[model samples]
Target: MKFGVLLDDHLFPEWRFYYLDYNELKRQLKVRTAANPQGKFAEQDEAAFVEILERELEKVASFRALKSDELERRVAHAQAAVDSILSSSDKPNETRMRAVEDELNKIATEMTELSKFVRLNYTGFMKILKKHDKHAGFQLKPTFMVRLAHRPFYKEGDRSVDSLVIRLSRLFDIVRTGGIRPPAVLPGGASQNFVRHTTKYWVHPDNITEVKLIILKYLPVLVFSSKGGKEFDPAITSIYLDNDAFELYLGRLEKTEGAEAIRIRWYGNMDQQEIFIERKTHREDWTGETSVKSRFAIKEKYVNGFLSGTYTMDKTIAKLRDRKQKSDKELDEMATLSREIQLSMLKRKLHPMDFLGYGFDHEEDIVRFPYAVLEVKLQNQAGSESPKWVTELINSHLVEEVPKFSKFIHGVATLIESRVTMLPFWLPQMDKDIRKEAPKRPPTALDLPSSSKRHLSVSPSVEVIIDRPSSVASTSRPNGPVSERTPLLARQEEDEEEDDDEQEQQKGKKSSDKRFPWRSLFASGSGTSLHIGAGGSAHPNAFLNSMIARENAGRTLQQQKRIVLPVRVEPKVFFANERTFLSWLHFCIVLGGLALGLLNFGDYVGQISGLIFTVVAMIFMIYALFLYQWRAHKIRNRDAAPYDDRFGPTVLV
Candidate 1:
């Protein structure tokens, strides 16, 4: 759609007057150009356009400042209220708590709308400036953009928004848990067993604040700290390593099994001394192994020498060993990992491909990603099952699932566009708007108190959902080609409903022959079955379909309803069992060979000894086979039986 229409459609109705007059500006340009009938605009016409543009900019900036200040005061008031409640010796007032929650929700909603408001207006100003420069043949954009930068509303990374979000998250967290504060990090720290199933989604810039607000309700904002100071932003800068041949890039792009990506990453900024040399190895599902990520820290000063193969981690390992902070086993593992990484880098001739930084100074070959990547990581023993809230958030219209989305691949494609033959599927989708009309949510039981529900007996006003117009027409210009300078103003499809439907239909057809009895899973208690429509098909949204599948599968599993959750048996467990079995078999083989030697080339006493040895060897072989099968079964069934043999090994010895 045209910038004017888009601005009108998405602008907060209450603050509609504050937005730039994009249509009026366009009209002014048309009239002046028609009157002149020439390419160049008169001095008066140019000045007129500039005056209006300046006025619009001033209007937007003032409104943004006012709203920001109001939001700050409201946030402060809410914080004080929360503090008072927490410090009180008396029982907590239910009414007061509810009121606080309501206020917080309102503030969150307003903040989201304000962010949207700022973004739309900023885009409007840019679009208008571009148009004026093109039609009037005046170079006004560069100068105006500088002025726009001075306006805080047009700038990215507003600290006020970040601070408010953090404060609101803390407040909501306390309220959600009934005044109990959770720890910054759980007990056991890095040693904790976290087998999380991570999924990535691409969030449009317009929806980032709202998405953050929704996520903050369930998960707290995780802030990192270092010897430097508390790094609240937790920004990361990584230089991905690949060769001139782009072998690693192709491997990662194709998601080939055992594909490895190496990178030198640092948190906060380049000034930080500690840098992490990280490697990620991709494993296919058929291999029964999940992808793994491992990293070892090194000083920033040593990075150049290490990459050049002139330095090894020997000195670092020696220091660690001398300090006695790490176990001998850990030190060995670290040394081994370092050696492997160094060897791989040297052998493959790996070098830096692209620089990926977050909230930091941009350097050469840096490709700033347009969309915010939201990774939902859930730690569940049952891989398919997740918390209801997380499921809802993923299924919501706020996110677009881009499976196996890699920052490295994106950077490579964007930075060296001419070099790479194959581009990622999402490359074309970058221009498309991922926004959709917000789904109307039914009031859940947890939404409000009984008293609040009683007040909602009156009929609600009808909410008209406006569908955005097609952008293919609006983006076309009669006089000339579209400018590549303003990517933000590029044409975009309003939605992907048709494409999504076709994809879902194909998936449905493929799974039709072996459709799981999803309805039966939910039929017992509620006497209601989840109707997935004809052909057992799902909704257009992929996340929603997966959630439905998970819900069905979870309900079907009898263990899911149990009080205690079962421990998941990883593929490594089975490998460990097999290794033990092989060791036993190895011992048996040695004994058997000795027995045969004695039987063939010794006297009757030797022969008798050989017979006993052969018999013992046979027993051991049989025992090893039995143990392997037993352990395999236990692991497969997730049995809580003890795996260790307290006396078997002793007796055998």
Candidate 2:
């Protein structure tokens, strides 16, 4: 039989057979099987399995047909309630909101119950088919349909079933849609006996988007509302607990099997009120097919006291220790956790090591469907990594090898590196000095070359113009090819008779004879050299090196002239500069705009006060701007000088 077609055919078929009880149904099936001895299901095993499955299917079909009208009515009513909440023109009152939430929760609970019944019967029938037909690959785990008795959602407080109801409803909705809209909202409160086996992969930021796409295609969202259902990674904060000697940190670093990392974890920013203090303990089973991770949660608020060595787990431990009252399977585990926490506090001198933050995203296949149910079994490698749904993510070209990333260790190391020498090896090292200034412009042929001259002097004013040779100059004319001949220097006439005497004296001096001393322009005296290199290129390296040297020397001279001040003056002057700028802005706005409007401000005391404040604010703002740059320059150049703060403006009001 084609199982898919058969399931679809009988999905909503009318219930033709009805019996009072299970025994009656079994008797009827037995009699029918005995009469049709040579029929398809005459064999004892086949008959028994088919009979039991048929009974389950019949019960579901009959129940649905009897309650179909009532179910429809309830659904419509619930939808109307939801619509009322969503379509409100103004914010609904708390009472009305609660009523609507309750109605939705009721509908969700009913739907989950219905789905559970259908799934149970479906699995049973499939298992029987696989047993009878060799070709049928429908062997499935038959679900035992046992409805859990309703209880309080929390041990204390409001204790409403709204949270669980909402979760079940959302999950059913996902199954109905075949996971088209992934449920992103997380189930509120702690999950009792929750086991978390995590495998972390460090991927490049550039590849995060692509990796997310692959994850979305293959794995269902772990939470119901991650980033408001728009597929953005969540921010996680973990306050890690440790001791003075960092025993836990060392154990983790050494890869100790039962080393526990205790932390208070919360999703989103620090504003999250719902927090969980958990101790994550991992152990590898014998077969190693599964790495067992046991997590225990404590009160979130106890984290501070725990670090301070004032908190005790006496109350909780007492509850778990009551073996006669409640022998929970997790009681021992909880007790162990309690003992461990206390021992660490007493023996290790435990304290809060660091509060670290990181962005986290999980990769897993968590969705289930009726026809095609997939459970990915992960085989552990030699190391700490666990099985992930998208194996491509773990061994992909986009990411490096699995990194030894511990948030606690890294955070502690960052704050006090002298204590923790073993830093995380994944971080890349960077060079200490990186060029911050714009690159110096390359020298052109027009630049004057500097000659070697140790001693130099300059007149108050000096001008040197170097033009290309006559041949090169003519080539620059309208109708000529460009001349390539290089020109060294051009002659100049001086008004002072001292020039004649200086020239006569230089004739005898050997220092003035060798090539033009370009360095002389930047002599010890007050003088400026305007070198007009109007022509051809010289030896490429010579003039370029000279220009660079000249630039450096000039910079050095300016540095010598600057006055430095104490580091405290930097911020003071910076604020003063800001104030001056704001004062100028005030002057422009109030005087420029207000005075232009020609309001009769002179007649009012308020106007007079406004004018006074504006003037005062502007004066300070202007003084601030000037003082900031001036102080910064002096400080940078290493010149120690007192900073001027006398004229600093005070508030007019």
Each candidate: RMSD to true structure? 17.2, 41.9
TM-score of decoy 1: 0.60
Write down the TM-score for model 2: 0.32
In model 1, which regions exceed 4 Å deviation? 1-5, 21-55, 90-95, 126-152, 178-195, 227-231, 308-324, 327-329, 354-368, 417-422, 428-653
lDDT of 2 by residue, 1-653 (tens): 23233333333223223211333433444455456645334455454655565555556555644444455566556556545654664443445545544454444434333332343333323333333342222222232111100110111111122233333344333222333354355523334343433434433222322333333222233442224655332344456678767777766654444667776666554455455556655332322333343445555677566556577666666765664544565666666766666676668776665432223211110010001001223433346343232353445543333234444554454334335534444321110111122113222111211111111122101111111112101111121111111111101001111222245544543243232222222111110111112222211234334444654566444334311111222345445655765765666566545543433455576566566656655565566567667765554333457755554444322
Model 1: worst 10 consecutive residues (lDDT sum) = 464-473
lDDT of 1 by residue, 1-653 (tens): 35565666677778878888878988898898778968668999889888888888899899889988898899899889988987884566667878888887778778878877876776666666756786788899877866765664654346568788888878776665557775554211343122445677877656677777766655556554464234454455667899888888877776666889999876554487878888888765546777877778889899999999999999999999999978888788778888989999999999886432223221111122445677766545434455555567678777788877776786666445445666676764553456666634334222432223223222121111111111100121222112222222221211211232245553563364124322211111110111221111111234234435664665445222222221334568878998999999999999999999999998999999999999999999998998899887666555777987777778877
Off by over 4 Å in 2: 1-198, 224-234, 268-274, 282-293, 316-327, 355-389, 428-653
Maximum-lDDT candidate? 1
Clashes (candidate 2): 17
